[model samples]
Target: MTRETVGIAMNGVTGRMGYRQHLLRSILAIRDQGGLALPDGRTVWPEPILVGRNAEKIEALATRHGLDKWTTSLDEALADPSVTVYFDAQVTQARVPAITRAIEAGKHIYTEKPTAETLDDAISLARIADAAGIKHGVVQDKLFLPGLLKLKRLVDSSFFGRILSVRGEFGYWVFEGDWQPAQRPSWNYRAEDGGGIILDMFPHWRYVLDHIIAPVRSVYAEARTDIPTRWDEQGREYKATADDAAYALFELEGGIVASLNSSWTTRVNREELVEFQIDGTHGSAVAGLRNCKAQHRAATPKPVWNPDIPATEDFLAQWQEVPDNAVMDNGFKVQWEMFLAHLVADAPYSHDLWAGARGVQLAELGAQSWREGRKVAVPELDRTGK
Candidate 1:
């Protein structure tokens, strides 16, 4: 069997999402599993060189994982011809400059969402990468989730014939830094840091809705800083300048409407931290992070509208749990494997830097809708104002 090694310059490996999900869980896990197998009896192995601003921390992290390489200089890492790919998991604001340098260095690029804090910057990066003729990708892990995968299957199978509407509930009560420490980083609440619920999550929603449900053509949203004040990691009191919650309405291509509530201040009263209920004429399904439940029109029960009498119907038992017919892998890891396969085998991969820019576009429109208190049209990304 033939094996090929591709060096990956993993930038911002020190950040929480970078370290935990992208680094340890996805990349390392792929390397541990004997590399990604190709269709032609070959295997592709990723040689990740951890890149960050702090040498000691990355070195310690490398040592803890028993890896050989770690570096503080991104320029040096990019300068290495061996490093064929540059993966960015840095803060939103840092993406443009870093990715610009990497693209100029002739490296394939993959990165976390919002590609940039604004639509213009995101489109600029996408255009630059396109002009440079480099392969590019954006992280859209939610599409690969088990629940969403099952939901997609249901959609594909026509189980939900002529889908009508979708309701999405995504959020959990993040502890305030006073009595209990905030679970999320303090930078998440500060607007100056390119941190806001809309910027952070609307990207995910855009991709998910476009891929799974339907193409989003318009959006009307309301954003708020639900929590006025919070404490930082160092027990420092700070004002939250960014929006913590977003109530959104979206219109899809097939006349499907979607309602979404994203917040860090609300309590989770559902199956998972994130869930979506899709309703249609023939059937309906509710999908959580890892599980999905469905109820068809044939299985619909008859009930009287008698709330005066005690509630007797077992509403929870009405929906049947969808079983996993195939083994499910970590969402992030799955995407990484696909990306590596694309790099080595020249496989068909559609989720690219332009897709990432669309995410940023949706977010900007969502914010605009909130500001103007009106629905905003989502035009196709034509950098030229045609």
Candidate 2:
């Protein structure tokens, strides 16, 4: 039995998403499982080298994981012939250059989303990877999310026939960095660092709508900076120049409209940070982070607006929770395993660079629409095989 071990260099392993998703949950967890099963009765394991900018931090992570391979030098890691795959979870501003360099070095790539801040940059990277004839992927983690997956199943099975529209609500009150030390990086609140809810999140929506329901043809959006100023850990105040909230309207190719509200300033009462409601001709379903509930035509509520009458109860009771069908894992980790399989075992994987570029395109267009107060047309990509 031929056992294949693919060497992967993981960049930005010090960050929250990088450490939890890419390293501990994906690589280490897969290692613990003795790697993934292959089609030919073989096993494919990932040999990962954690890469970052700090020696002590990387050393500590390596020590905690009982892995000796780590480095602060990206060029050195990329030059290593054994490192066949390059994964980036670096900050948004740093991703394109790093991934481009890795691609030039002939490494297959996988990285977290908003692959590049601009549509042009994302397309350039996609073109580079295609021309290089190397495998590439992006982290569209939301598609693998259990709740969203369940929702997709309903759509696929025609449970929600003749889909009408979708409404998305995503956000939470992020603590002031000075008082509570924000859970996300300070850079996430700064515009210069490629930060903003619109850019960070709309990409997820673009793919979700495209993959699950329909492709977006145009977008109209309005964005705002609700928190104009925030204090850092040092008790120094900084003027925030990025939008903390965005409300967008999308026109899908199939005439299914979608309305999305993304904000970091709002309080959440939902099951997860993100929630989606789909209304169709036959039924409607609501999905949160870990659960999905639906009401078919047979279960649809009958109601009339009456000042004194109590709301109908049967429809609420009929909303059924979707059962968990697969073993639960971190959403990010699920995508990582798929990426590794695609690289090492020739397993089919979506969320490739072109898909990622489309995400960037949506974000860029959304921002353009907000800035100009006009609808933005999404350009089609040339998906012809290279």
Candidate 3:
């Protein structure tokens, strides 16, 4: 069968995620592997053009990927008739303008999550993309993680019958940029640049909870800027006006309670940077980024609290490590391949702009909950392009 080569104009290719995940890992790797195979005995290949501000960086990325198409001008790339899709991995503050322009150019759009800093902007962008009649998607990479997939299986199979509650522990201590350079970009730490843990990650949790666990009816949150100041890559200290940590409690539609704690200040001592523990009436499962462990009713262990005694082995040994079921790719890469497949094969993609907008709405409401010291109800979007 003939493969459809979709022309993808990639903006913000010089950034860390853009360079590694979208360009080298997903697009170029797929092209290198003879394109992505579809279920219907066809393949979808991507023809990607790197777009960035730095000429040297663009050339270097192009050379590294063995591609001659590279551009510093977004306008030039948008004007090109061959580019049917526009992908943005730009900074949070810069994303709306570029994506808005892309929609105006009649290009299908895909971009990184936390679509905008504000809910209104996210909704507006969704409206614009729908009006343009273009396919749109946001990167919700966690849905494709192997561990999470296993958890989804258990949920679907009723292994966790009548889920009682969920606990999400996510954090890693970020360096102060003095002893070691910060891993993330400088803009990520600045509030003016649309940076904050609530804004950045709540969107992710929203989708994960809504799609996997339960639809959140309302949220109550408290936030803090644990690290008030940090040095940048250029050795300049900047005051952080945004919160570095967020503790939130969610009330789901079915009276299921979930708690999510996201922070940049906590030291990592657990299984992974992100871990989800789901407890049900029949059984329980704990999933980390790389692995999952389950305890069925039959295998469940009884325990009693005793201050004078050592911890019992019953609970310790009850968890059985779930076998790895599928070979895993980088989380971002999986979503990228899926997006390409959605475009070329007309496959159904769940992480559309409406989903993205919902994420933004969650973040916005989370902030409101924090400020008002009250629970904020989440509203569903109108996905009919109305």
Candidate 4:
């Protein structure tokens, strides 16, 4: 069997999501597993060239990982023709220019969501990448989660006949830096720094709803900054200008109404940090990150509402657990493997830069809806970035 290697210039690996999920879990995991196998009896290995703003951190990361290639200069990293793909996980404000530079250098693009701070810029990047004729994709890892995979299977099997509506709840309490250190970076709460729950999470909901249920046609949302002040990593107090919570109602095609509540301040009372319940005429399923429970129409529990009486029903126990027929891998690693296959073998990949742009569009429109106090229509975008 023959083996091939592809160089990936990974920027912003020093960041939390970048380092933990992409670098360690996905890329390094693939490398440790003897690379990605192709259908043609060949294996493709990933050679990561770590890139970052801090030279000391970059060098230390490379040394810790036992990898030699790293650089503080974007130009220097992109200058190497062997680096066929440029992956970005940088902060929102820094993404557009960095991605543009990488595109200009004729490299395949892969990056985190909200590809650009604005919808226009996101569309521009999509158009530019398309015009350059390169393979591109955005991280839509949630779609690959075990729970969502089961939901997809149920949908494919027509389990939810004529789906009607969906409800999603996602959030966890983030401590105020004063009493306890904030788990997230302070930048995530500053509006000027491109921090907001609507911007951060609406993209995720957009993809999940669009792919699993139906294409989102409209959205009505309200955003709020529940915690107005928070201390930064340096123990300095800062005003939280960004919205910490968002409640949204999305109207999708096929008359599906999806209501999602996203908040960083709310305490999680459910089984997982995030969960989505899809209800239809024939059946309904609640899906978290790893577990999914379904309640068919035949198994639905019915009870008469009576005030001043103790309830006898155990509602939670009514649903049956969905079995994992196969082993589940890390969602990030799964997407990474698929991307590699698409790059080397010309496999089908739908989550391109344009799809990423669609996510940005949804977030922009969600914010607009919040501002205007009305539902905003989501127009379809074509290849020309219209």
TM-score of 4: 0.99
Give the CA lDDT, 0 to 100, for residue 152 in model 1.
97
1-386, model 2: which lDDT tens digit per residue? 77788899999989988988888888888889888777778887888898999999999999988987899999999999889999999999999999999999999999899899988888889999999999999998888888899999999999988999999999999877777777667677889978898889989998999998888999999999998888765767888888899999999988888999999999988778998999999999999878999888987767777779776566457787888887878788778777877887778987899999888888988999999999998867765412
Candidate 4 positional error at 93, Å: 1.0
Model 1 global lDDT (CA atoms, 0 to 1)? 0.92
Q: What is the C-alpha RMSD of each candidate to the true structure, in Å?
A: 1.2, 1.8, 1.5, 0.9
Residues 1-386, candidate 1, lDDT per residue (tens digit)? 99989899999888899999999999899889998899998999899999998888999999998988789999999998889999999888788999999999999998988799988788888888888988888999999999999999999999998899999999999887998999998989999999999999999999999999899999999999989999999999999999999999999998999999999989888879999999999999999989999999999888889979998999989999999999999999999988888888889898888888889999999999999999999998764411
Candidate 3: how large is its RMSD? 1.5
User: 289 in model 2: Cα distance from truth in Å?
Assistant: 1.6
Summarize candidate 4's per-residue lDDT along 11-60 as a digit string, tens digits. Answer: 99999999999999999999999999999988999999999999999999
Per residue, candidate 3 scores C-alpha lDDT tens digits across 1-386 of 87887889999888988888888888888888899899988888889988989899899989976887889999999999989999999989999999999999999999998898887889899988888888899999888888898888899989989999999999898888988988888777788988899999999999899888889889999999988889988999999888899999999878899999999999987878999999999999999887889999998777778989888675656799888767888788788888877887778887888899899888989999999999998866776523
**lDDT, each prediction:** 0.92, 0.88, 0.88, 0.94
Candidate 1 lDDT for residue 184 = 91
Instruction: List ranges where model 1 is wrong by over 4 Å.
Output: 382-386
Poorest stretch of ten by lDDT in candidate 2: 377-386
Best by lDDT: 4
Backbone clash total for model 2 is 0
